[model samples]
Target: MQTALNNPAIIRFLKSKFKSAGFIDGLKIRYRSLICPFISLIKMVQPGDSVGDVGCGSGQFMLLVSEFATPSYVYGIEISERLVKNANELFSTLPRG
Candidate 1:
């Protein structure tokens, strides 16, 4: 977060993520269809399979996949720089792709 102290976009995005109730609500709505199917699909995929997780905020799911049976490489795409930073903090060694 210190790295993002000077970035308005990251600061604003993080502020909104924390200040607004709509963030989590909207996340649930956005992931309504994708959440389960993705886990199932990732389970089916063998090791080394390249999977892209779109809008991978904070990447808990990606970390879960990595911890679970998904030996395949997981890629995380996050539009918000705040999420990118948080995700990196949580899983520093995990590559974005």
Candidate 2:
């Protein structure tokens, strides 16, 4: 899964989510929005490990962790109930590997 983060489709999926969530305006915000969580996930998570994310906006970063690594369980903590709801709704659409 080393190259998973580099896939255009993966990036697009994440970008769309952020856009849909009104978290970003366009491609200008994509790199900063995506890379921060990508780096955090890569540096901190491991396959089959349980993971938790605080301030997990839209839960996209948690989803990225699942894609970039095979976490056994994933949970997110968000201050916004709306974002948590949206994230859960979006997460249901992701293909499980």
Candidate 3:
């Protein structure tokens, strides 16, 4: 099976999710997604599972889950209101299942 990281379309979609963000924030989000073991974490997510990410900066991991997995519910908490706002905006652009 092709992992989300290896799938160009998935990567493109993920990048597009951050297009409205500031350049530095977009870069940071992409960089964190690249460096973190999100793929491994993603693999553990079962379909219809409830996922939670604490300190989810811009909710990148949650976005990944929404794209790569079918979670019943996703919750994220961030200390930064700015990041939370950014995450909510990005999430709003996601296609409804």
Candidate 4:
């Protein structure tokens, strides 16, 4: 996972801590826009569905899906090291089951 933090230049830009509030709010709205479809597809996501999210900026959607769905594993490939670090930190603090 640490290998995700290798792009020093790109990481610097993404690490500037721009207001994620707007981004966060927009994310919720985007989910709302597609909730109906997502609900319909819920049954299609098998236990081992390898859902790959390309251009997954901050990985918020992956976390959201995990709350309701269980697969063999959830693997996200992100290009931004800054977001990777942030995700790592957030998940690290999650209580282990």
Candidate 5:
């Protein structure tokens, strides 16, 4: 399947979501997405699944879950206030279903 990492539009959108992030942080997000097996992780989510993620930095995994799955609920916990804030901002941009 064509994951977000393979899709330019998705990658662009992800990067754009981090516009307020520092340059190094944005780069780190991009790099993490490329290396993580997000596709496999996404595939594990079934429709109506209530997903939870630990250490979900910037909510990237949760973001992909929103994109690729019809989960009833998604939650993410990150220690960094900055990352959690960024995750909230990014999620706010997603269209409500």
Candidate 6:
């Protein structure tokens, strides 16, 4: 499945999220978004699949999966409590479609 990351609107929204997050978090987000192969991962998913991401950091990968894939469910596991909270906050903002 082709990720809509190429969509200008999605790129702008992701950039806005990065900007709103502070510098360190923004850098981490950028690394996760660009350096990590979330798009490639998305390609591997089939509709109705359930995905679990270990060391999911701030859940950016899972968020992208939720946005771009037809996965039945997405789960993210992170060690840091703060990151978990942040991830939950991020998830809350996303619409359940």
lDDT against the true structure, each candidate: 0.58, 0.68, 0.75, 0.49, 0.76, 0.74
Superposed Cα deviation of residue 47, candidate 2 (Å): 1.8
- Select the stronger candidate by lDDT from 1 and 4: 1
Worst 10 residues of 4 by lDDT: 1-10
Best by TM-score: 3
TM-score of 6: 0.75
Clash pairs detected, candidate 2: none
Write model 2 residue lDDT over 1-97, tens digit each, in one string.
Answer: 3544554646675666656444444553366544554664455776678988899877766876776677788889998989889788868877654
Clashes of 3: 0
State the displacement of the C-alpha of residue 35, model 3, in Å, after optimal TM-score superposition. 1.8
> How do the residues 1-97 of candidate 5 rate in per-residue lDDT, one tens digit apiece?
4344354545675676666768887776567656767667877888889999999887877887887677889989999999899788878867765
Regions of candidate 3 where Cα sits further than 4 Å from its true position: 1-10, 95-97
Q: Indicate the TM-score of model 3.
A: 0.76
Backbone atom clashes (below 3 Å) for every candidate: 0, 0, 0, 0, 0, 0
Error of 2 at 85 (Å): 1.1
What TM-score would each prediction reach against the true structure?
A: 0.52, 0.67, 0.76, 0.50, 0.71, 0.75
Show model 5 residue runs off by greater than 4 Å.
1-10, 95-97
Quickly count the clashes in candidate 6: 0
User: What is the per-residue lDDT of model 1 for residues 57-89, given as tens digits with 9 covering 90 to 100?
Assistant: 977656555654445577689999999997787
TM-score-wise, the better of 1 and 4 is 1
Please give the range of 10 consecutive residues that has the lowest summed lDDT in model 1. Answer: 1-10
Error of 5 at 46 (Å): 0.9
